[model samples]
Target: MPLTADLTSADLNEIRQSALGAADPLGVAADLAHSAEAGRLADPQDAGLALSLAAEIAESRSKFDAAQRYADAAVTAYGDRDDSPAAAARALRARILYRSGRADEANALVEPLRPLLTRYPDAAAYVTAALAVGGRARDAERWLTEAVQAVVAERGVTEPADADDAGVLFFLLQQRHRLRHALGLQHDTHDNLAERLETRLANANSGAAAAPATDLVFWPRAEFDRLAERTDAYGATWDEHRASLEQELVRQTAAGRTGLALLPGSVDALTAQAGIGGDPVSPENRAGYARALATGTARIAWPPERNGACWCGSGLKYKKCCLPRSRG
Candidate 1:
């Protein structure tokens, strides 16, 4: 069967989670890998991710040959990228090789990845995990410490920008703590912080933490510009509608509902998409559409890269636009 072009990151995550819970997880992962290899996925990098995940699943099941093949393909799919994801795939490849008793090859494959340790916390974490997988417990501990120090020097672990950043820090700290405990080492300040972070994250996940102060909505440039240029027949301004959307987001968050991303539409777009007559766009029409879209399985995480375009349809960098507004 062909993979859907409209698959979002959320959909891929859901698929992976489902596979993990299935009776034959390796089968589900292998099937996804096959579909991804068919080149039907809209994002080419997703194919690499699918293969990498399948490789991990196979390795866990002790299907080393299949795992190695999937890992090799994942490396090829990434193809010389210097990003963390590529590094992760390479690290997984090495781990697979090590687990298959190709220790020399595994060491060689991972040796060059040491430089990545200073550059990317995420990549370094993966490399350390690979070392642990190869039973290099001492080496893994030292390298993990290096990774933690590098990240603290660059971007302190205490202040994370979003849940994803928090998750990375959480993993780094959790793994280090686990390693220390296993090696009969005493707990340190870092270990204490890790315990606190774990508690905080658990609370947040359980809906006991406070809601986010603000969230962003995506805006296609053309539509945003068109809406900005005029008011609707119902006497509501574009700015008002935008503010309404923000308020609605706040309301949804306060109600303990997550994943409330909004991709608002102009009346014309809405009417066309909904197959309705060209009735002038009303505030009620816009609100109803937004509420309906909020319940979707797909989500768009807020706070785009600081240097990237603002999610508010503004033509400025996010740091200069909505990000400051959200903070202050």
Candidate 2:
């Protein structure tokens, strides 16, 4: 049966706050599931938060089947809201469907919602990713471009409440980043893969957006080297990792790992996942890394210079073409 009781605004708001603030979503899922059946957390909204959080964590951990179940539960939980949040759950499920090899079903499910894009940045991001997975990458970019423009156009006005999150602001720019790449447009910051991925992880956490880890600093290449070392994933085989690895060779390449791109956790997760445990950049490593990169021997070189020509060979300046799309 559908969850029937309406939650008090206080109850729902508190739930939303806690879900967004959660570091590890597993506990949130357990807690909500426990209370919800007893009518303590009765609203469909509670189910929305619980199932969506579980789905995101499942997707991040690469439990595709589990992710699909969580997403389906989320859509069912929303109980016919046909609004952006309901559509967001379906969009997320569409991604899992596509990845599970049901490309046509996924596309058919989410394509109509493309015209119903929400002002919520995360909703926009989800719909964009779903379209890209459905063999309509070009259409995804067009939808994202329009969705982003729509949000930016009302930045000071009708922006969603979550708009204040740095992650949300960052998401807007990051989607702008992917849209430019998908369309072969140029930009100044197209080459900074580390920042791109880090910002993405920050965005992926279920919240709109961080903590004291601003103290920990890292150079872009350090991030590349760190991620490179995680080749021995518990979940994926070497060949599988290698195939996705190819897309990482360039900053503009946007394939793979879309979940981490909009991570909702605070700077703490960002620090742990992307900042080398929040250790500051070192001069010795920086210089040595630079030399190795200059000689093309570094594990990962800094992206194309900001003032350099477009990576796409468009003869335009990087800043004009793609750099500006990044929040960095």
Candidate 3:
């Protein structure tokens, strides 16, 4: 039976957390299993995830039969997709089998999925955990290495392109670091870099000044120049807006307010704002614009990689093309 007609993944997460917080393992397992049963009709993937969590809770409560049942259901719900979610369910099922004294069954289930780890780096941790649960540490290490190689091939640079890339890289590195430490192996460059990234990401998430971040909308020089030439107001607002925006941003940054929105206006609204005459945009509209930008607006990360392509859609590298005018 479905707990609710419409329960998003977020809702399921909250439910799980609430049960855990209350120290109710039995309740957590029951609720998650029921939710997964209902959730499978709406979102099979999420339902699979929920069932995996339910299996874990059941395992912790020493209900091996129930745990195996949940894991099997999770695997079925996930289907045969070649993605992280499907891999995760299979891994969980393998772990449950191993812990339930079905070692041969566990190995058989997980062996074919080794190739899946190489194809999807994000699935490595799940597979590694399952292997560890089965006391196959060396096998886990080998698969982990393959996943790291995949990450290297996909990323192709020391510096990640964005936060998501950094996150994945960090996690894989962290896992490898811990495993090597346990095996009494010497640290490598990747391990050292993982330590550095740990600090960097920690500071970034905690909003520390040590790791500065900002978001801004960019208008390519050629496009803005054309608009400026179309009207005196456009030209005037261009200069005034540029200088004032930089000043305001600098002031806000100094005040430790990193997240902000300088909502862009349309050509007519820009003209009206500059007093060159069209219907003026109201304060309420401006407030709504800011809210929209905060919630779902897409903006470029300021300061593109020095050797990377410029954010302005120019063919030249950032340093050679538009870095000089980036402040404006």
Candidate 4:
């Protein structure tokens, strides 16, 4: 079958999420590349986006060459049009290079985009992450500072702008915390990010905790204790997963989904993937196993109200779909 073109970004997101959740993502990667080719024959613009997504999927799985190949195809398809998308494709390539231990090449590909940090926070984050991985702390910090400015530059009252700012702030907080923790030096910048993170996380946790059992998957206090992660070491595993979970929620909300979906690449998913044979609800292997559960487990989030989005990722309200009365 020819691949589906004209897929909304939401559809692409579903494709990506399904692929991530699949036990063997290799099959999905192959299918994605094939679809990219078919999409190219049908529609170049859609093909470019599909290829870019394919590249990202491959990169997520550490298939660097596959990512590069798809990213190259995406860049070609996007040619001479909006450079932002193609440049993002290049950023993925640079990320692959950095992960593959080619720091110089990655830096070269990334440096020119410094001025764009205020617009493309992901690019800035990638540059900083590449530098950090390359043992270039000072360089990484430079980009981190730039990324923070990008977030601060975006303060606004508009909904779309606020949404964009939230996304950028999430990225910045994740990177900034890591950088600051490693440096062991408190800075004004860290203080700003920490404050934001604390407020956001507190809100998210409270909402999740106070939400009805029917709305969210709430474990009892004892159940939570049974499976909760604990370590004598100062582990920020929860912090890391929490940030990603929040980011995924934001994305799903943007797609107008009432049931926010978490990515499957969490530590919980990793532990589950490792074939560790232990009952998840049991207290045995409590820390590691629970950490895995916390990171990878799907937490169902009900829409704020019937007027809010549907759980199915469709950009519609609960009143329009998915309600018992509405479904009838």
Candidate 5:
């Protein structure tokens, strides 16, 4: 049969299943590209769909470069023809940039697209892209916060939610957890990003959307389990450390440190002690701290009363929300 004649919904479903089952996404992407170019698919949406599937599979496999190429192809093929597809492409591109350590570039690329995102604010792809850029830019904490609120708002209006779009929520939660950490806020690190992933999976199971049990045949279950364990360990350590510090502070206050006045120069001295003197804690520290923490052994200290606002300008009270082990 001619290639186009052979195309059917069953064939499309088969291709999707294969894209999800294939361990080698680059190979599947190549085949999809060939098929797409040969006009075996119905339209650009089909091509974009195939590319999107390939990109997701590649990402699950940690083949970021190949994922980027596939994402680029998806975007180009979709060509702003469909809002949803365009948003998905943009999200995929931002994700690839983030994975490649080009956070600044990713933020820049997404800034112009922010207005475009407003139209589809509730769409998972748009929300994911917005949060990705906001978190990566290190200056968009407010934007990230608002994005979370937006997700909650959207979920309130829609019952169950869309499972396919659950990735957006997962990404947003990860971004929120990261942002909180970057600003030195106390957060539950027990599950870290995995908590969000599990929540999304539960939502999917609840009929929010149709989410497959795994991204592809190789979903890195072992790696995820290992990471979850590490998350729990770190969370426990931080909690214990924080409790000890609080207890010490209380004892000191009882012994006569009650006034606890932080002088102007104290901020500077503390900054220097933290090895971040002269570096305004705003945009620069947010980005640097996140990177450092990812590699382990990073710490920051700021008097809650002295630091009126979060370094990221989130407008939240520093001590209550962002300061490390702070009681506000």
Candidate 6:
């Protein structure tokens, strides 16, 4: 009858990871439902974990209807007793509403939680969820930025020199990038931000830090090449350009360079110069020329003059990993 005996340590750990991975409520709900039905719900913590995961998974999967049920279950299992957990459940519900295009409803749901932000400033999940649904991009960006700063301060670390924490930092950096892009700020404005991240990576490498290979997730390199080709296609739409830039941003952020600047030009200009539509790469077309210049600029300006070394200790330029795949 001992709970510890009934569940292996590995099983517990796996469940814990799954719980943390729950970015959707429905996923968390389904997991907990299965566990409860199987008569395997052991501890409150485990149950809470199941709820969180289910909710997150459901949200990400765009199953808002299912997510609400799981969020409620999680709140109930957590006894709806603790303010933190309750707030989290509420946030999950809000996320579902937001994803379902009921933004107004979602905003109203989390409006009451505004006061909590000042108290639990470091609660990135709560803050992000609240801002996202609240229809306040500027506010959300500020909160997210502050939260990241507070985390860095609490750790007494100026830089995330550790590779194991790269994933988390990468997400933060991506958020920063998105915020800047959404604001329509000039690309040069992020130059300093890019430098700081590059320096952090270099510092980690200098310390001979070794990130667990197991923790690293490698995307297929071919995907990047394919994206490059697509972006190069003649008559590419704005959406296509945006998608390509977004993918490039994700890749670069993972590698520790957060700066992604889009050139100030119209999509038509880009397509015309690239000779994209069966048009040969020519001086008049200039598409190839522009692409080459952009790629070259990124590489040369990378490592931000502030970052002196590579985080992998390879003594290579940060752009080798952090820059977009070069066409030139």
Best by lDDT: 1
Model 6 stretches astray by more than 4 angstroms: 1-31, 34-39, 79-87, 101-105, 112-123, 133-135, 145-174, 182-195, 202-328
Return the top candidate by TM-score.
3
How do the residues 1-328 of candidate 5 rate in per-residue lDDT, one tens digit apiece? 1234534556656766766665655676666666766667755457776676667778768888877888778777877574765776676677777778877766665665554443454444444544544464344445555665566577663222223555455455555555565665443422233343554557546755422211111102232233334233222443343332333333335434443321111223324434734442332342343333333432222234645763223466755543544341
- Whole-model lDDT per candidate: 0.65, 0.51, 0.63, 0.54, 0.50, 0.49
Better of 1 and 6 by lDDT: 1
RMSD of 1: 20.1
Residue-pair clashes per candidate, as listed?
0, 25, 0, 2, 3, 20
Q: On a 0 to 1 TM-score scale, where does candidate 1 land against the true structure? A: 0.54
TM-score for each of the candidates:
0.54, 0.43, 0.57, 0.50, 0.41, 0.44
Off by over 4 Å in 2: 1-44, 132-136, 148-174, 178-184, 188-328
Q: What is every candidate's alpha-carbon RMSD to the true fold? A: 20.1, 15.6, 18.1, 15.8, 16.4, 13.7
How far out, in Å, is residue 228 in model 2?
37
| Model 4 score (lDDT) | 0.54
In model 2, the Cα lDDT at residue 98 comes to 86
Better-scoring candidate (TM-score), 1 or 3: 3
Worst 10 residues of 6 by lDDT: 211-220
Model 2 Cα lDDT, one tens digit per residue, 37-93:
344554535666566666766676677887787888778788878666787888899
**Residue 63 lDDT, candidate 6, scale 0-100:** 67
**Clash pairs (backbone) in predicted model 1:** none
